[model samples]
Target: MMAPEDAALNGHETDKISVLIIDDDSQVCRFLSKIFTGMGYSVSHELTLTQGISHIFSGRVDILFLDVNLPDGNGLEAINTIRHHPSPPEIIVITADDNVDGAEIAMKSKAWDYIAKTGSSKNFRFALERAVEYRRQKKASLSRNDIRREGIVGESRGILKCLEKVAVAAHSDIPVLVTGETGTGKELFSRAIHACSPRCSEPFVVVDCAALPEHLVESTIFGHTRGAFTGADRDRTGLMKIADRGTLFLDEVGELPLEIQKKFLRAIQEKKFRPLGSKTEIHSNFRLICATHRDLEDLIKKEKFREDLFYRIVSLTLHLPPLKDRGEDVAGLALNHMKNQHGANLKNGCIMSRPFMEELQIYDWPGNVRELFNTLDRVCAEAGEGATLFPHHLPEHIRAFNIRHRYAVRQTETPDPETGSFEGPLVPSEPLPPFKDHMEKNKAEYLGHLVAVTQGDIKACCRISGLSRGHLYRLMQQYDIKNNADS
Candidate 1:
């Protein structure tokens, strides 16, 4: 038996290993439950995808046996969210479909195993035992490896998953491709990887492909001889040479010129390049890391980017979620920013009001973390010597946007007096409800419709509603609404 503290450090909470079976088939659940029980493990089962997710969030679940098709939604779609769980379980995708595509998806999603539900009982048990053994070894490894996150904030599941991947990338020399929307901290992750890698002490060179002058792009990366070009007054070392035995981070690699892309691909593949006007080739050894906000696949389809270069850079991929999708991480990010920007103010007892934090959480930050920090800086300046921050401290545009969205939601929910239906225009004679009461009613109705439309898929609900998982769960509990519309 593992100590509680040790288990927690390994992302588990229970002394004994726990397993969860999330399949609607009663016979399947009973069968799996017995197998787990016989292995001296605790087991639980949920008949719907929604309940299964709820159970995972509410307690400790070390291993999950997930079904592809469920009563509420497709279980495969929930793998991303489950992988981000605070104490993520090792997922074993169990399905009767036996579709080749589904198996590919499950493996890509990082599921421990993908096996047909119709497989023999012995096969099933073998999978479980192997998965459990892997978990044990992984936990032991995790208990000893503490990641050093440089200036990265938020302990939300999304951020945690990213950090876990960062730790994995740090130990390898593999080329890494980090993708995310603008302002989502792609460069920060790249730097973190470099900082944790074996070459941490070496120089970490950066080449801003988007900022390089078109004519000088080649000489800038591969160096230039004294007489290479008109302006080549003296010998100049390129970024590639400077990054030798270190890390070479290509920021916004998508912006590389087509000709430059061809040269860069060869340089990376061979670790040797000929500087301009030089008859001999120079050798440089460096680890590669790239960051991009654009869809390289689409770029490849459009022929704007080379297909070979795309594959060459993405040996490992890490995606950073948008701030809006991070849920409660906003609070931690805000606090961390405040401490760095206004440490003295914090020491003086300045605090954020609940309404202020709620307003922050409700707004969809288009600029992500960078925008949030900028907004907070402005708010702190405006607060001056105030003891606490309030909703009024927020930028006017943010407040205005929330007001308009709320009103729009209300209008969408308003009904026609005569027809008593939402499809018709509201009657002028009807009185408007109190602001608080109207908002409360509309919130419930909106959530209900959201669940119905998304068919109880939590991922869809989050995307559609722009709510974080924790925030959505809290609202569901507050309103006493089930994740499924039928409930």
Candidate 2:
């Protein structure tokens, strides 16, 4: 038997494809295995249906040739168990008894193709080639969706790992639970996952679980029949049915009432639910992706959330780090948003001075990406006409927040080589020299602050600081500050 890892890598190799053979006839397994092996393919064969299912879950097979009538049991019995896997290998039924009903059942359960065992090697080879081609196309479609929405742009190690997991989980129909502080772009990530999934063309529905009333939660998610409740005048489909064959994003999912948790669990487990006051169950296929800013484990411990539901919905969990923790991404995000928002205004776009960018990078964004966008918008709006971005464009809160961070950073007081004590230039405790001796120092600090506050518009900085244009140039030269603040 080929190793699982070796078989998985077969898709990339020329003249190789991972094939799993399932048949009660030892001669048939040997015949197919020999034929496939001669074609430079990696093949695994099992005489029993149970072992075939086990090998499929082993991640060693790309394609399965299952016998419809297994000695142990019928292939239809194992369809549900196979579909439950994160990445179920593609299956092609091979049976001596050819029936339209069996083929329909196999296809409905997501089998790739169904072929009768006519004992023809040529026909088997053709079926194998077709399955490979279909899987290849499916993989390509998934790749295109991943690059869209600029999935979680960041350089931080923590965020990158989260993105890697998202990519792996996207290929599966498993439920995902995303947790983070408020404004952490949980919704953005959820949308990206859905877009990159096989159901990309379908609707990506969102439910604000926090906004729904406790009594109306069931009606909102699971719909209601006509005359089911006091206000129910007509039949309605819930988010689950409406988002059928797509994705359902439950934002602030922790806010869902304890009583509703039980119903939600059943809906997810069976992928079918009855509308309120309805006797018949409605079927809907949707990928569940839930987000919450609250600690769910704590809620579960406190008897506020169902532990069973939590496990079901949390097949994969992604905990996003706050914007403050994303280090260098802050400045990159600002520039990206600025370009995206003010493309035509690029010529007048506030060229972020290095000092201002540095300050923006260091400040903690409590509101995360949302706060960053708001701050950038404020800065762009407040800038003078024909002006580029500057510090003055930012809101008072952000400016003050940055200033506090700067003060805190300088509090450490890095040592200077020229001085015996750990006193450095720009240290918080040290006083700047008088005008004559340290004129350059004074000029640099004053002009730097002016540029940072005004967003690097030399003219605006000169106007606000009451310094002449010529004086600004002279000051820049004296302080060794770059004059291209408008760049």
Candidate 3:
């Protein structure tokens, strides 16, 4: 390890900047470490990508020097994960292979720099210096503007990264493309962008590309003059026109008609369009924001979308991660939703039992945030005047989904009967139990736990299980299960 010197000598800030180098090559690690240490920055090295990623999440790393090929995995692929860190470090990809394609991939993944091992030491030093400077400026800029998160929730790394992007995008007029799974709140982010932008005081127009009538799509977008069409009994304003001096958010943009893409692209480029039956063009200056759950690239490949339009709208891209990947954000989102929607109904603020939260975290929310909110709504409704929520308050389907997932995991962990080993794939040594019998056993177990948790309050049991009083009694009788409150 090289001794740290005054960073001022290198025109760097006196405060130590942390740098992580993840390269299997010992020589490369040493060389990078010496350079960073000499510049008065603290340096750490890892031999594998996994260790590097773990180190990043565990502490503050201002910059990272990543190798494309490592002992465990390719560093290039882990860029997204690193970039989504709560305080992500600027990545400078250093690879032995001077592959042009690799450089393109690195830059596309938003790496700060991509340098080949064959490059001069001066090149590496220059890259490091620039990355540090850029990060300094970026931090200063971010510290100046706080993003306005209207209805957005969660402080997860993924959400924070997107919010940072939203803050940056709001200061510009460039077109933005927000992509995520359905129910991931694309429009909410768009609205946040608009709300934070200079055009916040102006109208924020929404054009649901998917829901627009096929016949009236063009008329609705570009507007229509009186008598222009059968429904054009009078003059009408288009969404684009209505969005003048503001934002035009095209939700589900992938659903936009292919035939209209060319015209739309032209209007976006020129900021001018002629409504139907109009002889002259009208210019409507509007900031464009588009969102889609579909993969625009795949659509382009399928010839269903225009390549030009895809490039035009995606000047800046923000990807919202699925809820399952957001980790503990699920609990925050649930509690927030409960407070906003059901706080008044309960005398005390609604609280979620630990088991209730665990069940929520385990289930993979396929529908993302929208689905999670809907599930919470149902739970609140079922919970009624209850101040606290339990796993039993969840709908039967969600509860069953979590149970099924746990069962699947357990099945995979089952050891081999003869080998007594869990190393290999699970192969049944005996005939599997009947599906009906297995389900009955699970049902009995669930009901027993529910009764214990609810303490046999029949009314509570009925409310939570969504079962009629008679049904609950019949199940209790069939299973020979007795609770103190049972009639």
Candidate 4:
């Protein structure tokens, strides 16, 4: 291991600027370290290129101060090595023998600044301060450009409120828990959160906690070395490492075993973990997002889930609204799904008939948006070609459904005490006509009553009958129905 030196803070925590001084001269390294230390900077120094590279790769050293001469190699070449880091530090080439070639090499290597050892202290201070400020500004700009959320569809109060929380959650790097019933698009929410985060470019790893078996859980999540366990023939990287420096989403998080939860808690707390049989630990810096349909609180009470792990993961929470409660968003979602499937090929028109729209609004979507999309897609396919989606095209159960009055009693007849006969709500105006004639007369009366109620609105009448407007008008004329609607 290369040498590592860190100054102890006196219990005071701040975002201290870290500096690495790489020089072969012991006196110069110590002197420069003392100068930065007195300025409230966290300082470390390495006498060799190997030690400097090791320190940088270990995820420390924000700014690097390099010397032209090293025990093992030239410091100018070390610029290429330093800049290769995933998040490289700003470099300042400080050499006693600065020359034209060295300055050109430093600029080509993207060095932040070049300072000669004989340069004044004021010049050195100016370059270091400016480099740190540039780093800060770059980070801020990257975050500002990262937010880009899409795919969510809803404008109801419940969904609008949830979106507000989602926007707030995207700006931070903390664990978020999204709770909702099945088919509520939990995974889509996870993707939206990732797209709107600073780590958007990084991979978005998903772990379906409930789908993995007990035996393969550890191997899949924490990886294994070759011959580390039985049947382990090759090196495998864990999902945690794959998700390093990005988002790790755990769907159905309630299904995680208590034992696995304990192991995960420690790894998450330390940002480090080891393969099943490995000795050295691997560090994974991942933003977490967990989703579950089951109530984790109830699982905790039943001892099925760990309460401690729950608190560790649920730093923020957002709950999605089911489709039944989204009101007009249901119509909007249906239109979107239809347009997506039909594209521009819906030449005969893909509009839903008035009856179909009313039925959709009143029906309780127990299966949520997933079920709604499936039902619509099925109906459209079964409709064949050139036939618009009408209420009659809907599934039998959905088309037949009618919302009953909440307070209306059942239409049961009661016997009167004064007479040994039953009472009916209505009496025939005259003796019933012949059976066939009676049916025709009743149908005409009902059609006239429908026209009256709808105030001659042909579209409204067709919606009530689940029939075409032309059919309703023909029936009205055949029945000799005459009302103010004709005027």
lDDT of each: 0.84, 0.78, 0.85, 0.78
* Best-performing candidate as measured by TM-score: 3
Residue range 1-487, candidate 4, lDDT tens digits? 1001101111223247899999899898888887778878899998999988898999667889998878899988888877788879999999888598998998998998888888877776788889888976775455334435365777788876666556556877878888898988898888888888788899999999999997888888899999987899999999999999999999999988888899999988998999988999999999999999999999988999988888877777778888878868888888777776654334334578777887787766778888888888776655544555666567756643432311121233445779956554434346846655754775788788878899988767765555676877788789888756769
- In the predicted model 1, the residue pairs found to clash are none
Candidate 1 lDDT (Cα, 0 to 1): 0.84
Tens digit of per-residue lDDT, candidate 1, span 6-70: 23434543347889999999999999899889978899999999999999999989889999999
Total clashing pairs for each candidate: 0, 7, 0, 0
Candidate 4 structure, TM-score to reference: 0.54
Q: Give per-residue CA lDDT, model 2, range 102-198, as digits (tens).
A: 9999989889888887767888888888888887667555644464557356768777656655675577887888889998889988988887789
Better of 2 and 4 by TM-score: 2
Q: Across residues 281-391, which tens digit of lDDT does each residue of candidate 3 receive?
A: 989999999999998899988999998898788877888999989967998888777767644444444578899899999988999999998887766655665547777
Candidate 2 is scored at a TM of 0.60
Per-candidate TM vs. native?
Answer: 0.59, 0.60, 0.67, 0.54
What is residue 234's positional error in candidate 4, in angstroms? 1.2
Alpha carbon RMSD to native, model 4: 16.1
Q: Considering every candidate listed, which one attains the maximal lDDT?
A: 3
Point out the higher-scoring one by TM-score: 1 or 4. Answer: 1
